[model samples]
Target: MRKDKITSDELARLCGVSQGTIDRALNNRPGISPKTKQKVLQMAKDHGFIKNQYASSLSRGTSNLIGVVMLNLKNEFFSQLLTSIESTARSFGYTTAIMLSDNLEQVERQCVETLVGMNAAGILLCSVIPDPAYGKQLLQYSTSLVSLGNHICGEIPHIGIDDCAAMFDSTRYVLRHSYDHIYYVSPVLSRSSKENIDAQTQRFKGFEKAMALQPSVHYTVLRDPDTYQSILKSIPANGGRSAVICSSDSYTIQCLQLFKNSDVGIMGFDNPTMLRRLYPQLSTISYPIDAIGQLAVKTVLSPVKEQKSHYLAHTLISGTTIK
Candidate 1:
């Protein structure tokens, strides 16, 4: 027998015990003596036998893998969220397989198929898919799903921020500050070759509702493919104190780049840690993204998932950008 990659049976033979005894020791299951387990573990480690629990789970028709699907990694908020989810999942002894949908419905559908085929225990999706019927179809596979940023399906619980409420409050904060003009910046609609998106769509709706509170206030919804370019032309040349509120911090940061110190009040949603630290003066709606990750892991892995959804509180930060 090779010294490397010792099988469980081989380890059992070397330890002079039954294969079941070795199995119990490696898996830390009951019915094995501490001394025996310690010896088996030490021996296995000495021989470089790292048990493949993932493969074993597949054999047992179960899984300890969490599937996480989202849009691209370029978005600061999504990147931060992914890290939180990964770290939280690991604490619960579950590994994760992450896939990016690139904001395409077909790509998201394929990602779901692949994760399901891999026997994933749960899928945490920041969904891009447009149809709820597809969500029902996934349920047919008896998969446990939880949504983070988007509402891929209403059935899936939301463990993230309430985009509508947060954005509404943020917009109101801007209005209260008395900016003469407000430019609402968002990616526009959730559309795929097929679909916030789960939250992104709601965010715009929230902004609209908030704007209605002051119908007379001059506001422009800059939601084009080239939204930043529009911003340059949209702001009044007469210099009436204007403000630009983006749906996410990524967009807010982009504005800072385009119009550095130009005196346009810039506000954004989702105060991501890195960005916030780098641009502390950026006004934003701060959501506990880290907590969202922890809750998502617990909700998905729980045997009884009684809670259908969650709405964590968001704090509005009145930073220098508002002035």
Candidate 2:
């Protein structure tokens, strides 16, 4: 049979099995021997047989596609999360359909409508908008919905790190190292819209609370547009030990380069690879990216229950940057 024309019948013939047996094995239906199933699957793989998921879904009245909606992929953290979510979903015999909202509520709504219209099996959303009303409207589409990172809708199951606690710990870690000044630098909190403000706000609140406990320690928040220049000037002129808690790894790396010759302590979030290489000794708060992805899929597929949120823990990884 021609490569492009290879069908289930051709695969069955090559495997010395009936078409019925091939169907059962390929679809993972019971009643087929393990040996026969393996042989059929191997033959299908060798022949480059690609199952038509859309056609199969149409026949079964349910799609195996899991829809994922999140903010922009400019941040390495979100990109890593998307990769983990896709890989985890595929391991369970499901495919992913991804959409980006660029932190716009309207764009996020449009993505949701499109996924709903396509009858996606479930949706894993790192919601740009934190509006419960919009989330309620999404529930009318009849697909399982799970929130990632941010709790956009209170009713939906959410999987995320506790931003407040994570930041609070990070702040205290830096403080304990004899840093007299703490600078919380976050571009998002300064410029993001309401749809993208939840996580940043929580982190800021955590940083504030930690600073409040140490009244003698000087602290300042540097938003975007001016943060870079401000850090460059402040760290050197402060005349004392100072530390910067960057909102993300990208920002942390940027600050690291700026302070490469200075003695400023730096801490970053998400622990990206670039940060690891640039400053393997950089302190960071590690988010459970893989666990978040796996749990998001699990929550969507599991039966509905009282569990509305799953806040995974974050770890404070110490390095030379903090000391």
Worst 10 residues of 2 by lDDT: 225-234
Q: Estimate each model's TM-score.
A: 0.92, 0.86
lDDT string for model 2 (188-277, tens) is 776565655777788888899888888998887887665556665667777888888987776887788888788888899988555566
In order, candidate lDDTs are 0.82, 0.82
lDDT of 1 by residue, 51-168 (tens): 7776787786768799999888987778888899999988887899999988777888899889888888888988767676877886677678998777656666778778899999
lDDT of model 1, residue 280: 86
The CA root-mean-square deviation of candidate 2, after full C-alpha superposition on the true structure, stands at 3.1
Q: Looking at model 1, how many pairs of residues clash?
A: 9
Off by over 4 Å in 2: 1-23, 33-50, 224-228, 304-306
